[model samples]
Target: MALSRYDGCGETKLDCVSPGGVCFDPRFVGGDGVTFYFHGRKDQDFCLVSDTNLHINAHFIGKRNPNLKRDFTWVQSLGIMFDNHKILVGAQKTSKWNDNVDHVVMSFDNTTISLPPNEGSKWNSLVMPSVTVTRTSNTNGVMVEVANNFKVIATVVPITAEDSRVHNYNITDEDCFAHLEIGFKFYNLTDIVDGVLGQTYRRDYVSKTKVNVPMPVMGGQQRFSTSSIFATDCSASRFGLNTNRRDGVAEYPILHCSSGMKGSGVVCKK
Candidate 1:
């Protein structure tokens, strides 16, 4: 079969010098939006485009002279079949870890549910001794296993309980600055999120606060200004609130991160 007219670049042409990454932002099911990203290098150009057939392809530009290496080379192409149900389901669960892993979590309500292990470990050996399993207080959960070489990898504890070294400092509040040290271990699960899961992090900082600012109610001219309020003070800072808080029913201490790593131990003083 011959190639369709919509297979290649139509009227509008794009160029890339050296592209680092490319992504398509398909907002909805029927959304026809497409974006092309370009990252340029010295003489070579890397370009990526989502064509009308929902095929995303990457191309690289070579030398300018009339040689075989001068022509654009097709690197890779990703065909996104939105209309196919099986393909859509598989695409939706590209990086899901819970599909085949088995993890057991014991709850206070006498519920034992198997969850998916985070790091994709196959047939994990979770050894809980009779003495330790019976006492189940705030004790450290231990897991011991014998290696093939018979070397004991014993005494494993949580990384947060170990000693941490601080690197830099950050500002916490208007009059307070925080010294950040690496203490806790936080997993960076910064992956591509969708819909509800994506908006959860963005709306976390939304809280109830009373703003006592004056403004025109019906577009009428109204001069309102606080003597203490300055033009520079009106500027908003796009950082995090570095502090500490209690977590869950257990009231575990959770460090507030604003502008540093999640595991960074930020200490604020008056």
Candidate 2:
């Protein structure tokens, strides 16, 4: 390593290239998997040039033409992982209007936030949910990053008894309430080291948290849309070398409520 002086500061050897760029006044920024603003001339005051060309992070640059399918245009899922040197990005198909990529511009060995959950509290519970993150250090591997606010929709069947003599001989006037909450405590990928489990594995983090999502109320017992949070079995487990067999079970976590009259003991199907 050689020490190079910058702006009069004593020369300091660098172990790694940080986010922006390194020496030679690069008119382009090409770290973290995405290259932006590159000038054709290499030495002619690279950093000072204006109107530089920006390239897409991966091969999906330019207009959508031949290779990628139309579904790729609407990236529904996105994830960023930081490991040894490269940044890994994962994008899925979406039906949203943004036709752009849901997952883009991720770097290896860098700790970036995961994708947001499906549909939940867009402001409080869903946006920017945090998860325990881990990424593969190798080149072009599955990137695993911490994702917060991961949520899934489940069906809740209301077990109600029909009677004509409960309140008004036909129907009641009081509004029934059912408190529902769902959560999952997933182990951090960083805890597994050299096949040994670390103490941090015991700590569980809430990937997603949802509150009374106001299920539609109808006559007697009815079917309602309930929001829940649980650990999902991701298929990318083999890439990052996972340990500690924790079943990514999405079946039962625990359902709780405040009042118990409009509904009874709730049972989840699939």
State which candidate has the highest TM-score: 2
lDDT of all the models against the reference?
0.16, 0.20
Candidate 1 stretches with Cα past 4 Å from truth are: 1-186, 195-198, 202-270
Model 1 agreement with the true structure over 125-174: per-residue lDDT tens digits: 24311111111112211111122100000111211211111311121223
Q: How do the residues 1-270 of candidate 2 rate in per-residue lDDT, one tens digit apiece?
A: 111123232222221122122111111111111112221111111111000110012111112224423211111112222121222343322222131223222332344534343322122123323422222111111222234212211111111224223321222233111111111122222322110001112224211112132221111101111111111112111224534543322112231212212321122121
Residue 99 of candidate 1: its Cα lDDT?
Answer: 23
Model 2: number of clashes?
11
**All candidates' TM-scores?**
0.13, 0.16
Task: Tell me how candidate 2 scores on lDDT.
Answer: 0.20
Candidate RMSDs in Å, in order, are 27.1, 26.4
Q: List candidate 2 segments past 4 Å from native.
A: 1-79, 90-208, 214-270
Looking at model 1, residue 248 earns an lDDT score of 24
